[model samples]
Target: MASLPPSDEATLTHVQSVLQTRTLSSPIYAFILTPLRITHASRGLIIARLVLAAPHLNASGSLHGGVSATLVDWAGGCAISTWDLRTGTGVSVDINISYLGGAKLGEEIEIEGRADKVGGSLAFTSVGIWKVEDGGRGSAVAVGRHTKFVRGSASKKVEDAVKTAE
Candidate 1:
């Protein structure tokens, strides 16, 4: 299996620590029940695990569509962060989700996010959520694409300065 380099691993660890210790600023994440266990992290990619629970379910006792969208938003940001290890991942410009299947309570799901392109002013990402069965990834729960406006992010500014200097 592919693994994160030491530096990226440290970044992932720090992010996980922040999630565990801090009261999440995003109310949606708190409502969804936070602290997603990051299974893997590397440049432009992140994989995390979340267990479906009461808050994550709809009245019919399946994973909520809103929750799936929220995961797309959240995971996309994490993938963007991997580009430069920036805490601020930027603001969502657009998000599109396709509900492919359902996951039940007590079921574990894996969310994979990929930063398809990270430019100075914008970042594009895709997220896939799947139910885990028999210790492997099972049916797809949802797939989404997220776009973010990242102009003036700290890392971008620094990079811009370096380019100017060069």
Candidate 2:
């Protein structure tokens, strides 16, 4: 196989879009894709920022672990999911999380995550959920770590074609 091409989320979305419409027959995606947009995207790293209202807040008037888990899953997945665009396959194997402070309700929480390391068939990612003020220092309320299973062959077809044309 040739060297692998660099990857990104737009790249993955584009690649997955067709398959999503065809093979990915999930009705749940309709709701997840609408209203809540994927604010940030990139290869290697990704961050998703969400503004919480009443419904998203927890019973004790704080962010919920389930919500936090959603952030962990998405961020971590994005951290490594870009691989499928370049090599074409993978999934999450294990995910771990630690709660720090209680994220207050009504505060906008931003979930940020990046690949800590990438080895042969595994990707280690770290995620952080924080309360960020418009122009002030933010508080990290939760953190998560994930191990993603990676697969498939590396190829430089796209980059190679572009390079050859250039």
Query: Best candidate per TM-score, number?
Result: 1
The residue pairs that clash in candidate 2, if any, are none
Q: Write the per-residue lDDT of candidate 1 for residues 96-162, one digit (tens) a residue.
A: 9999999999999999888999988889999999999998789999999999988775244324544
Candidate 2: deviation at residue 123, Å?
A: 1.4
Q: Least lDDT summed over 10 consecutive residues: which range in candidate 2?
A: 28-37
Please list the residue runs of candidate 2 whose C-alpha ends up more than 4 Å from where it truly belongs after superposition: 1-39, 83-89, 135-137, 152-166
How far residue 132's Cα lies from its native spot in candidate 1, in Å, is 0.4
Residue-level error in angstroms, candidate 1, position 152: 1.5
Q: Any runs in candidate 1 off by more than 4 Å, and if so which?
A: 1-7, 17-23, 154-166
The Cα error of candidate 1 at residue 49, in Å, is 0.5
Residue-level lDDT of model 2, residues 67-124, one tens digit each, is: 6776686666555644333433236788888888776755666676677776677778
Give the worst 10-residue stretch by lDDT in candidate 1.
Answer: 153-162
lDDT of 2 at 78: 55
